[model samples]
Target: MERSLSFRSVSILSPESANGRNVVALGVADAFARHGSTTIFRPSAASKDPFTRILLDAAESAIPLDDSIGVSPEVFRSHEMSMRADIVARYHHIIDARTLDSTVIVGTDKSPITDPEEFSLNAKIAADLQSPVFLAVCTLHRNPDELLATVHACEEAVDEAGSKVLGLFVTGCSPERREDTLNGLHELPYQVWTVPPQTVDPQSEDSIRQSLESFRQQVPADELIQASEEDWNIPVTPLQFQYSLLHQAKAHHKTIVLPEGEEDRIIQAADFLLARDIVDLIIVGERESILERGDALGLTQLHKASFQSPHDEELLAQMTTELCRLRSKKGMPEEQARKTLQDASYFGTMLVVLGKADGLVSGSINSTANTVRPALQAIKTKPGSSLVSGAFLMCFDTHVALFADCAINPNPNAQCLAEIAIQSAQTAQSFGIEPRIGMLSYSTLGSGKGPDVELVEEATKLLREQAPELQVVGPIQFDAAWSPQVAASKAQGDPVAGRVNVFVFPDLSAGNIAYKAVQRSSGALAVGPVLQGLNKPVNDLSRGAMVQDIINTVALTAAQAD
Candidate 1:
């Protein structure tokens, strides 16, 4: 929530025991919308927030509604401080994404809030947003004097937290007590809005608009502050990462060729991508057969997908020529090239190389070798890359880490290891992960000496030589690399020790095992084996991959495409 004084904004929350705060919050949000471009930001367990949904429906620029709503309340319970920072960052992201002219900062209305310090949480979030606060108190179905005490107590809470209270509204009061309540609040120093119960029919737009107009006129314009920039860096949540990945793929509008259209998973993924309009999809299979299969599966969305037959005479001829020319140095004769193009993987890769499509997704029914070999032969590796590598986006609830060399390498030598590290870092960067690498070992800072450990140390040195700006820690145990307490005891005073987001394992056995262990044990969403270091984007899905897996790989592949 950076400086945007041009946009009117305020933070509204119930003080401890207030009722009907959501009503006031909604009114305020509606009022702000009258002025110009307006957004609503609610920070809490936002997975299923009704109020946020309403606001989202009204906002012009739509993202996932939960995108503006922060983490689950239970998540915020343990990760209060870090999650608060994340909430602040989400606010900033929404503002940037919406390019807001106005915003309404709101809180959840439901009870059973898990965070014991609920008021404090909202207070700090408001402080971070650098917006003034409005504490609304409800005097419905209760004694006015007792509610006044709650209001008085809340004054100190917001004030002690240094939140400037712009208004203290006595909202939701019934008509019978309205006059007495207003007279009773005459002694109060802060601005007050004694809003009686709204009487208009729920479906009347004119009444709603009039109420909103009244609320807008009431907000003190002179006190409104534009959001200003702050130096806030927080990890994006898993939900956020997935949404962002799909959103980017949709925005770039890249066409991805899916080679295993015969596989049920791939066909379903084609439907999934097409249903969302995420990308223009091409499913490589015999057109008639794929249509028959799609019909059998009740996947009408697949109607939008273009089906390409690898056996198409003209396409095969072009691919044969291109492949022979690209692989001529390796002695790929015309006969071999023609035979290769018959394979769907090779045909799909050729489509990308020929610019018929932007990227390729294969391997649902093929081996990784079958999938990657065609790309390696025709598309080749980018500059500074001598070998290809694979990275998984280990998406934890509140952050994403890139697990490297997990699929491609078996037991790379020091130089190959370093190259994997470099490629992994660059891949992570492209995917929005700032690479803080942890080169894993059984030893930490020479606690044990072995050839394996020596190889890791040499790889670290080589990685630093190749990419000096990366934050890397090597010859470190996994625990030390992840846990600050463990790092202090094992490898003290190293900046990158405890905060590693990119884990480069010593070998495939370790890398594969580690990612799987964390994924299954902790319930993290592991997306990829994102094939890295290729000149063009081509990803291989596991044979056991689900339909969703195909969709994810296609989306990632599209994002990687130019």
Candidate 2:
């Protein structure tokens, strides 16, 4: 079951006197988005700068060009606070209706109001929104005393207006001087984070995302903040993707049966998942071996584990009988079934078939054939799915794309390729990606002729006739599939020609090699080989998988069970 989202809001104010206020605002919005908050950024009344537009775009928020108004800066700052608040309120109303959780960040004018009377109006605006005010204070190469005075002014200004100060954003700190400036505010009671000065391309998505993660970590957990901290140990996958998997897995609370339970990485991942209450784990292996391995690794979280030995007599007998019944048409006998069930892959798959576990995740020490063959034999495909397929969730720092047929299907025909595309789109949707699919080939539309291009073109036609509601385009090359400008030149007015989040390959060799190349060359993280089309979820992990890899696969398996 999906959890209901609750709404929360916050606003940002800067010492109109501060330099780099725009940079600070961008950093804060990024922080909110990174933490899984649907963020809405409303520029200050005086903010019509290009950087502000770029910043909003980076945050995936847009303030319409029609909202841009030409007003005298002095008059706008004087009485426009109420009107600006109303505009923000309207945006909040619309966003809150559409989303369960969100953050609204209202930017402040360039200069802090110098007069005490004007400062009171600023506070009233904060009060009107009923949100805690986050003050962005850029040192501007000021002395310690000047910075301290600015902080004092913010504290007093929010306090006087019946509004609360959420925290202080310290920006424009030279990398070497960051600690020195932060230390100067040791006496301040509110939260403080020193944002690194922006690079020449400060508005770059990757840079802003990293800074937001860093900034959000400085905030106290109790504060009205939403953001995730980056884990250096799991640098390949994005933290946001990890968080999404965990959130869904937690909601489902399904059981995952791990076949390579005694493997060190598998044991560690199982320990973490069980301890975190993300999944109910059942490890299939020799109980004593796993326990000893867990102990030697100092796995404190292993005490929470549940173990199942493949050699257990009752389980073996029951699974053997079921296997014989399922494969008997192929002339399998009871003895052969019993012997085959001795392998943990078959045994774990049996657990899902027998309704003892919701899903299975293997391939840690096994080959893809070893992990998948048993699943195909036992759990089989869903009612309408002809054959199983796999997808890799390719995650970059700020974006995620799905590459499909990467781990299965050596060479699918037009019909099989069409199925692969449709299945991959469903899989992408399951992971929260809106699937705009690209059926990739060497050609764009009818530009090239070859068996490969024909295969992709036929698959695209089949997909359109079968599921026209699906956003898809085919016989599209990689460049045109991804770049809108290139798409315009090659395949105009086709929705999926560009802006595609899902890529469907004609064959396994192409899918597998491309995802790996992108993973290796672009420093993008590839999570899975997530097996799809199974009646019950059973995923494979690379043999060189890390502890985090197992954890991710397990969570995804649990989520798929739902």
Per-residue CA lDDT of model 1 for 1-562, tens digit only, reads 2435665567887754333565566566655665567777887744766556665555443667777776676766766656765676577677755557777787644566555567766766676565567787877755767777877777666664445566776777665787888777777766677666543322555755555554445444333222211222333555456666776788788999988888888888888789889899888888888989989999888879888887789878888888888987888888988887878888888888999899999988899999888888889999878899998999875568988788888999999989888888888888878889999899998999989999999999998998899999998899999889999889889999999989999999999999999999998888899988898888888888877678778889889887
Q: Report model 2's TM-score to 2 decimal places.
A: 0.65
Those runs of model 2 whose alpha carbons end farther than 4 Å from true positions after fitting are 1-237
TM-score top scorer: 1
Q: How far in Å is the alpha carbon of 419 misplaced in model 1?
A: 1.2
| Per-candidate total of colliding backbone pairs | 9, 4
Alpha-carbon RMSD, candidate 2: 16.7
- CA RMSD of each candidate after superposition: 8.9, 16.7
Per-residue CA lDDT of model 2 for 1-562, tens digit only, reads 2213444556677755344555556555565555554545453454455554655554565545324322334644655533543443344344534543545455545444455455555555555444567777777568777998988987787775556676777777676777888889889876677766543244466765565555555544434363222111221125446656876898899999998886889999988887778999889877778888888998877767678988789888888889998898898998899889878888899999999999999998999999999999889999999999999999864457999899979999999988888888898889878899999999999999988888888889999998898998888998999889999999999977878889998889999999999999987778898998999999999999888778888998888897
Q: What's model 1's overall lDDT?
A: 0.76
TM-score of 1: 0.71
